[model samples]
Target: MFHKILIANRGEIALRVLRAAKELGIQTVAVHSTADAEAMHVRLADESVCIGPPPSRDSYLNIHQIVAACEITGADAVHPGYGFLSENAKFADILDAHNITFIGPRADHIRVMGDKIEAKRTAKRLGIPVVPGSDGAVTEDAEAKRIAAEIGYPVIIKASAGGGGRGMKVARNEDDIDVALATARSEAGAAFGDDAVYIEKYLEKPRHIEVQVVGDGDGRAVHLGERDCSLQRRHQKVWEEANSPALNAADRSRIGMTVANAMADLKYAGAGTIEFLYENGEFYFIEMNTRLQVEHPVTEAITGIDLVHEQIRVASGAGLSVEQKDVQFNGHAIECRINAEDPKTFAPSPGTVSHFHTPGGLGVRVDSAVFSGYKIPPYYDSLIGKLIVHGSNRVECMMRLRRALGEFVVDGIKTTLPLFQDLVNSRDIANGDYDIHWLEKYLAKADT
Candidate 1:
């Protein structure tokens, strides 16, 4: 067991890790920037250290400062919450070199999976279904065109290192291929410093489903079912639910076991998620997130498992106590990512929260760090909180989410609350018949 764990992140996730560590009787050290000196995680931590200035590169992403804080605090383990360095292989390696435990997967897993190209190859080699695409990176426009033509028209050009809908372009025909390739490479280069691009046959109206898998570091792993994250805007997930409505029981079981077996074959450790695009009852591997996901609350709600706790345990050389058969999915769970943004325009809304009111009930859970008088820093993501609800069925979960969203009150800043409210009342959303492109199309129609 870890005596003291240093959290190398900030905001809601930092607080989430702190609470989990404390529940396990472990002391926590919160490392924050000067801008977050008065942050909730810092205030609640057993000890707090100001690492650097406000900018992420100066503070949250500074490995040296974080390691220094850990050394000074004598934190034996480090929990990188979700973003920043959570999936940074170099950071994990550095921590290992310093004899500090990184509460996540092995460095190699993160390294391989962090690259989109390599991840797809791994998935395919592991017998997982992958979208048809080029064998490797299509560096030249000519090669990209060749690959796109071979894969048929309507191919998507993606950066080898891109995510969040950045560095991606779709070509519906040969005429669009040249522009798509050139622009994708340029954008990818600007965004990730690597212009390497690849091509994949685009599946229209696919559902974004991901399987959560945990490994015990000894070739043993289990899946905790799937999360449907089809409701997204700007390639960012807006809503997520466990037990994907798109999949039947048999389809869910097959995909879940496939991912679990693949993790075992790779000897993956800690927590990881295998994202896929589902179309016409087929699952195509998209990518693998080598750390906890932003939508993990829905999975935990359905499984009744603490992913943070299991991640720490696995990192400490403890085996996963629960077997595949022992794991059981419960009721349906839904989560709405509450972001400080304009409901219609999706612009960033960062300011002082004048009043904050959280909803309460049996199935509603609000994972947030904001409170009255808290100033939301503009340096980080717009996500301020996650509103999660669970119920015996999807209908009940939807109703509960609607009620909870109505009760959630945040003043002095704009939020996407109204967007979710409208979604909950829509007959299309009520039937859970949405695909990955649904939200963007819905929003587009609203603009007119």
Candidate 2:
């Protein structure tokens, strides 16, 4: 195990990793921007350093400053909690150059899975079913039109380097193709600095499902089942559940083994997820996340596995302690991302919390760093906390989640709490009859 590890992100995820390290008898160093000086993770860590000013580029994204902090603190390893530079291959390479351990996948693995187009090809080669799309990046207007016509209408144009619904456009017909290509290219350039785009046959009601896998990086790996993240708005997941009601036992077993085998084939290290879009009964590969996901808690809740601990152990050169047969799934779990945003407008809400109260009970868990007086800084992502619950089944889980949502309180700030409250009562949500676009359409209907 690492003697000491430095966390290279802020907010709850930093705290999440800090606690995990401490449990393994590993000391922790927390690095933050000036704006996060009063952050909860900074307070809990054994050592803290202010890397730079408020903006991320000057701080969290600044590899030099973070490396300096690790050097000063004598941290032998660095854990980048998701987002920011979590999947940055260059960051991992830099850590390797410094002889500092990166508590995640190898740089090469990150590189292969970082680009969407490359990931699709890799997945297809690994025998994972992928959506029919362009043979490669469509750089020419004429080529894009050809691919679109080949794939049929209602196709989606996506930035090879894009996420969070950015740099994406849908063309239902030939007329919309030109504008979509131009706009998607421009947006992708602005967001990822890579104007490369790809085309895919878009399915209308695909459920977003991802398989959780952890590998020891020595041709051994394990899968902890799947999470259904179909309830999304603007391509951002709002709710996630383990033991997806959408999947059957046979499909779950098949996908889980396929992912684990692929990880073993690549000699992948630590934790990662193989995301897929499920339409009808077939699963099509979307992309892969090379690091821990925010929705990891739900998987852990149902599987009784500590993914963070497993990742650190794998990084420490230890083999996976649990085998595929040893893994067990019990009950159902759900996670609702409680962000600091308006329930209606979805605008950023950053301010001091006047009052805060989190729900607690059997099978209920809240992961947050906010307090009664914590001031939410506007410079970072709006997610403030996660409310996760577990139960004997999905029905019981939703009941607890709804009850927990009512008990959660963050006064003096706009939050998505109201939205969740409305969601739990939604018939579509109750029946697990939602897809990636279900939430967007639901919200659009509310405007009328």
Candidate 3:
């Protein structure tokens, strides 16, 4: 076991990792920007260090400063809690060179899975189902058009290194393929500094599903279950639930086992999520996140497994603690990502929180680091917290989530609480009749 672990991120996730480390009797070192000196994670850590100023490039993303902090604090391991340097293969390699363990997958795996084209190839090679499209990057307009025609029209152009909905465009027919390809390539180059693009057959209405798996990097892994993140806006997940209301017992077992077997074969280490798009009883691989996901609480709520704890254990060379059969799924669980933003316009709301009140009771959990006087930094993400609820069934879970959302309050700044409150009461959401495009359409309809 590591005597001290340094957390390389901020906000709720950093606090989440700190708590888990404490539970395992591991001392934690919290690294923060000057803007986050008073952050909750810094306050709770055994030690704290200021990396740099507010800007992420100068602070959170500075590899040299982070490595220096680790050396100074004598932290033997680093747990990058998503975002920033979490998926940076070079960062993982640097840590390895310094004899500091990275509490995640191998650098090679991160490198392979970070690129869309390579990830698709790897997924297909691993026997995971994938969407039909070009074999590799579609460089020329002619190739893009050819792939679109072969895939039957309604193809989507995506950046080979894109995510979060950027660098993606859909063409309904051959006439729209040229503009879509040009636009996707331009956006990809601007966002990721890579002009490479690929084509995939676009699905009209698909549920966004992801399987959660943890491996010990030794041909041992277990799939906790799956989460349905179909409710999204601008490609960002707004709400997520476990055991997917759209899937049944057989569907769940099939997908879950498939992902687990793939991870075991690849010898993947730590926590990773294999994302897919589900349509008409079929699952198509999209991408793989080599780090803990933002919506992991819902999976934890259902499986009763402390993922962070397991991550630390596996990274320390202590193989998986639980076997595949021992992993049991409980009732339904849902997570609402409460961002510090306007409910209507969806603008960023970063300001001092005058009053903060979180909901309580059974089957309700709020993961946040903000307090009454905490000032939400404008330089970082606007997500202030996550509200996760679990119950004996989906109906009970929704009811509990509704009650919890009503009780959640944060004053002196706008929040998306009202949006969740409205979603909980909607008929479509209630019936679980929603897809990847559902939230965007719902928002558009509500505007008019």
Q: Number of the top candidate by TM-score?
A: 3
Ordered by lDDT, highest first, the candidates read: 3, 2, 1
lDDT of 3 by residue, 219-268 (tens): 98899999999999999999999989999989999999999999999999
C-alpha RMSD between model 2 and the true structure: 0.9
User: Which portions of model 2 show Cα errors greater than 4 Å?
Assistant: none
RMSD of 3: 0.5
RMSD of each: 0.8, 0.9, 0.5
Best model number under lDDT: 3
What candidate 1 gets wrong by more than 4 Å, as runs, is: none
Candidate 2, residues 15-78: lDDT per residue as tens digits?
9999999999999999999999999999999999999999999999999999999899999999
- Predicted structure 1: clash tally: 0
TM-scores for all predictions: 0.99, 0.99, 0.99
Give residue 330's lDDT in candidate 1 (0 to 100).
Answer: 90
Clashes of each: 0, 0, 0
**Residue 132, candidate 1: C-alpha displacement in angstroms:** 0.3
Q: Which prediction has more favorable TM-score, 2 or 3?
A: 3
